[model samples]
Target: MAHTTSHAAPFLSRAGILVLFLAAQMLALTAGAAPYLGPEDEPIRLNANVTVTGSDVRLGDLFSGHPDHEEKVVAAAPAPGQRMVLDTDWLTNLARTYGIEWHPADAYDRAIVYRSGRTVTPSEILAAFKDDLVTKGMPANTGLAPGAPLPTLTVPSEANPPFSVREAFFDPTTKNFSAVAEFTGPEGQSQFLQVRGTGFNTVTVPVLKSDVTRPQVITPDMIVSAEIPDGTLKHDIIVDAENLIGKSPITFLRAGQPVHDTEIARLNLVDVPVLRNDMNREDIIGENNVTWLTVDANTLPPDAVTTAPYLIGKSPRHIVAGGTPIRRGDVIAAQQEIMAVASRDLPLGEAFRSGDVDWVPVGEDSIGAGVIVSEADITGRVTTRPIRAGQPIRAIDVTRPTVIPKDKLVTMIYATPIMTLTVRGKALEDGAAAQTIRVANANSNKMVLAEVVDADTVRVVSQQSAMR
Candidate 1:
C-alpha cells in the first residue's frame, strides 16, 4: 500500500529459522510421543527401539544368559555417561500397575560393560548404564535420555598365573589320565579346583614352555628309566708278613774288631743281606709300631759300631747307633766327634748338629732325590763309583776291594756292570716272571732256573737252592 522498502529475503536467516522450527517441532513430537505410564498391561515405551556399544562386546554375548530376556527390550545407545541407573520411582509405579519389577541382577553392584550390540529402554538403559557406571566404577544416578549414546566400557583381562603345580602322582602299571585345567575370570571373579590322582606314573613328562626352544621335563612316571643298584662291595685282608725279633740271640762285639771268615762262625750276629721279603716297608723306613733302627749304631766307623766288619788300614765302619738304618745308603754320627759317613766320603771329626752339617742324603734316591730327612743319617746300599789312594775309606769310594769274610757266601750281586751279575730270567710258576739268580764271575750258566723279568737282568736270591 505504500512504497515498501526494497529488502531481499535473508537466506541465511530464513534457513536458520527453518532449522529452529524443525528442531522445535521434533522436540515437541519426541516429548509428546510417550511418557512413563502406570497403565496396566502397557509397555514402558511404545514402538521405540534402542542400541548399545562398548569395549566389552563379549559382555553383550554374555547377556544371552540373563533371566527374563523376552520381557526386556534392547534399546538404542544412551547418551555418553557412566552408570546404568534405573528410575526406581518410575519403574516401581509401573510395576505397581503391571506387576513387573525391573530390579537389578544379583551382580548389579558391578558395572555392565556394553558391547556394540547391547541396547535397552531409557529406564532400562538408564538402569544398565547406571549399573555399568556404578559397577564400572562410575557415580550413580547419572541422567541419560532415551537417545543417549553410551560409551564403550573396557573389560578386564587375565593376570599372570602363579607358579603352582596342580597335582602329582606315582604309578607305572596302569593307563590313566590326569590333568589340571587353566582359566581366567572377570576382573574381580575367581574360582579354583584341586584334582587328586589315580593310576599315575612314578615318572612323567612335565608341561613344556612356549618360549623355550628345548624341552626338558621329567616327571615321576617312567619305571623303565629308573636306575638300579648292581651290588654291594666287601673287603678282606690276609697276613702278608710281620717283624721277627731274630729267632736267635744277638751277640755284642767290640766296635773296631775285624772279623775274618773263620771268626764269623764263632760270632753270634749274622750279616744277612737285607732283602724285600726280609723287611716290611715299615721295618727299614719304619711305620706304625715298627721302629726305624738307629743307623748311628748300625753303621758306625769300624772302631765305633761295626768293628765286626771293619778292615784295618783298609776302611773304617760307617754305621750309626741312634739313627734310621738304610738298606744300602751311608750313615753319619759321632766318629771323632762331628763326622759324616757318606757312601763315598768317610768324614772323620767332632760333633754335628743342625748348623755344623754341610751335606745330607735325600731318600732311597729312587725318584729324583726323595724326601730328605734332617737330623737323621742314611744306610741302604753303598757301592763305590771310584776310589783313590790315601782317600778316606767309604762304601761308594772303593773300586776293587775284597771282603775279609771271603769264606761266607756272597748272596747277591746288585746292578754290577761286570760279569758277576744278578740276571732276571723267564716267567715261572704261572704269573711269576722273575726270580733271583746269581751269575758266576766267569760262567754264563744255563742250568740256573732263574725266571726272567728283563732279558738281561735277574735277582740274586734262592729258597729252593738254600734248602737243598
Candidate 2:
C-alpha cells in the first residue's frame, strides 16, 4: 500500500510532460505572422459564344395537324428578366465556335468520323429519284400510295387510303428502311397476302391538328454517333475540362472521329432523326407470315408514340409457319408499332422530334454534327387528311337527315380557325395556344359553344343536337 502511493505522484508527473509537448506546437504556429498559406483568391473570367443564323442552319417544313407548341426560354440582356414565346416550328441550328484548343483539327487532313447507318443519305435514293422524279415527278408535292416493294423514290398521292410497299433494297454500306404489311382482316382472308417495302413508300393517314409529320430521310451530312437515335446518345466527345481547365474547347467527334477543333472552326451538319418507319432492324431477316393490323380499333396512328424511336426487343410473332397455323401465344418476331407523325411532313426539315428540344439531356455525340439544309428542304404542309373518330363516336345520337343538307356533308364541322395563338404566364407553357373562340358550321352564321381540343383547334356540337 505504501509503494502504490509513491507511484501515483510519478504517473501524474508524466501526464504533465505530455501536455507540455502539445502546447509547444500551438505556440510555434501562432508565433509566426501567419500560420498557413492556401490557394490565392482569384476571379474566373466568364466567357460566352454569340452565334447568329447561318446557311447550315438546317430547316425543314412539317404540317401541324395539331399544334406542336414548344416553350422557348432563353437568357438575354435586353428587356424582361424572363421571356416566354410559343413555338410551332422545330427550329434546329448547329455551328462550331473557337475556344481554348484541346485538339485543333483541319477539315481536309482531319478524318471526320463518318458513322455508318447513322442517317438515311437520300443521295443513292435521290440518285434513284433522278430516275424516279423523271418518270413520276409531280410539279407539286403529294404522298405515295402504299404498295409492294416500294422504289427508292416516293411520290405523294391524295387518291389512295392505305398504300402498299413498293420495293426493298439491301446495300452493304447503306441499310435502307423496310416495312412488311399483310392483309390480316377481310382484305385477304383466303390468301396469305404479304408485301415488303422500303422507306421510300408513302401512305395517306389521318392526322390531328397538333400532330407533326416526319419522313424517312437519308443523308450523308447529318449522322448519329451511335447506331441508336434516342435523345440520349453514346460515343460522345470528351471535353477534358480538368486537364484543359481554362480552355473551353469546341471539341466534337463523330463515330470516334473528331469533327471540330479545340479552336475556331466551321461545322456544317444538322442533326435530324433517321425515321425507322418499318419495325424490323435494318439487317434482320424478314418474316414470311406478315400480320396486318385491323383498320378499326387495332390501328395505331403515325404519331401514336410519345417515346423516342426504339426497336422492339422481341422475335417475330408468326401466326403460321410454312402455312401451318401456330396456337395462341407463339414466339414470333416481336412487333412494336408506334404511331408516327406523317413521314410526308418530313420531306427534309419538317420532321419534329423530342430530341430537337434544347432542354433534352443529350450526350456529347448528339451535339457533334449539325444538320445543314435549306428552308425548302426542312418544311412540308399538313396532309390533307380529314380527322375521323374511331369507336363510333356519336353526337348525341342525332337523327340521320331525311333529306341530307349539302352543307352538313362537309368534311369537318367546327369553329372557324381564328389563328394559332400563343401565350405565356403562370397559365401557359410555351408553344401555340388559343384564346376564347366560338364554334360553328360552314353554312350557319350562328355561333355555338365549343371545347378546346388543342392550341390550334376547337370542337363544337352541331346545332341539331342541342335543339332536340
Candidate 3:
C-alpha cells in the first residue's frame, strides 16, 4: 500500500503541475490580448476626437496603443460628421493570429470626423458639441479632442439608450438653430433634445465678378453666384445674370460686391441717324452717306436727330466725321435769295436788256449782299464787266440806259425852298434816270453837278450835296 500511494502521489503531483503550467500560459495569453478584446462590461472609453489623414484610414491607426505592430487593416476614409466601423473580421483574425483576444460583442465601432484640405481643430469639435447642448438649454462641457485625454462614456443598459440628434430647425429672425434629439430609457423614450444655438443663414446669390465703372454694360461673365451670409441684400436687388446682363451701371462696384435694384439701369432702345462719311456743307445725305442706327437712348446726345429729313438737304456747319452722332445743332439750311442773273455770259461793254437777264433763286453767298439792280433799271444798260449765267446783277456790275447822251444840251434846274430857277446845261457824261453826272450850265458855261431827271432834263444839285 505505501508503494501504491507513493506512485499515485507522484503521478497526481506531476498532473497538477502540468495543469497549473497550462493555466499560467492561458492567463499570460489573455493578459497580452486584453487591449484587443474591448472592455464590454466596463464603460466605453470613447476617444472624443480621432484624426484621419490621406484618402483612407486603417484599423491599426485607431489601435496604435496595442503592443502588436503587425496590422494591415484598411477601410474607406470617413467623411466629416460620419461614423464607420474601423475594426473588421480581418482585424480580428490578425489579432487572433498574434495570440490576441477579441470579442465580437465589444463596441469597437467608432464615429470619425475627417478634414481634407481644411482645418478642423479639436476646439472646434468641442465647441460644436457645446453649442448643441447650449441650444437645448443644457449646461454641459466635454472639452476633449484627438490629442486630449479620452472621455469615458458608459452607455446605458439595453433598456436605455443615449441621446442622439434627429432633426434640426432654423430661426432666421434670430439667426439661431435648434436640434431635435432622442433619448430612449427604461422608463420611456424621450425625444425632447431641443438644442438651440446661434448660427448664420447661408445663401447663394450672384455677385459682381469684377470691378465695373460707371456707364459699363453688364455682361454674363461679369457676375457669379457665391455662398455668403444671408439677409445682406434687398428684396429687389439683382441676383441673376439674366437680370443684370446688358444693363448699364449707374454707379461703380468692386469685385464680389453686392448689387442694389437702383444700381443698374434698364437699357432704353432708341433709333438715331448717323453720318456714314465726312461731309461738307450742302452735301446731300443719301443712303451712301447716312445710316439709321439703333442704340441706347442714354448713350446718345439729348438732341440727337431721329428722322431722315433732319439730315437730308441740310448743310453741315463743319466737317462731320463718319459715324458721327447727328445732333439738331450740327446742320443748317443754306440761305436763298431771288435776284437777277445774266441769261448768258455777257462781255465787257455789252448793253444789258430784259432779254439778257433772268430772275432766279440762288445762294446769297454766291453773290454780294450789297447792291440790288431791277429789270427796269437794267434795260438797255451796258455791262461794266463780264458776267456769267446765274451771276447776280449788281448796280456796279452794269450801267443804266443813257437818258442824256454825252455832250448833249440839257435843261438844268436849281431849286430852293422859296425859289425855282431853270437853266440850260450841257451833259458832261452819259446819265440815266436818278444817275449822278457832271453838267455845264449853258448860260454861264460853268461846270456843275446835276442829275438827269429825264431825256434832255437835268436838275442841279448843291456842290455840298454832290460831294456827299
Best by TM-score: 3
Show the lowest summed lDDT stretch of 10 residues, model 3.
141-150
Candidate 2: tens digits of C-alpha lDDT, residues 230-325: 222223422232222222223322232222223312222222222232322222223322332211111233333222122123332332232122
TM-score of each: 0.15, 0.11, 0.37
- CA error at residue 389 for candidate 3, angstroms: 6.9
lDDT (Cα atoms) of all candidates against the true structure: 0.29, 0.26, 0.63
Count clashes in each candidate, considering only residues at least 3 apart in sequence or on different chains.
81, 63, 5
lDDT of 3: 0.63
Misplaced by over 4 Å in model 3 are: 1-216, 219-270, 275-279, 283-291, 294-313, 318-322, 334-345, 358-377, 387-395, 402-409, 414-420, 425-430, 437-450, 460-468
Angstrom error at residue 367, model 3:
5.1
lDDT of each residue in 1-468, candidate 1, tens digit only: 233322334666788899999999999998654432324524433111222333222212222322333334333323223334333343344334433333333333222323222222223323433343344433232222322243332222223341122332222343222323222223223333223232211211111122111111212221111111112111211011111111111232222222122211211332321212233211231222123222223333343323312211121123223332232233222122122333233323312223332343322321122222332432222223432222223323322222212222222333335545443232222211232333332232222333333343334444333212
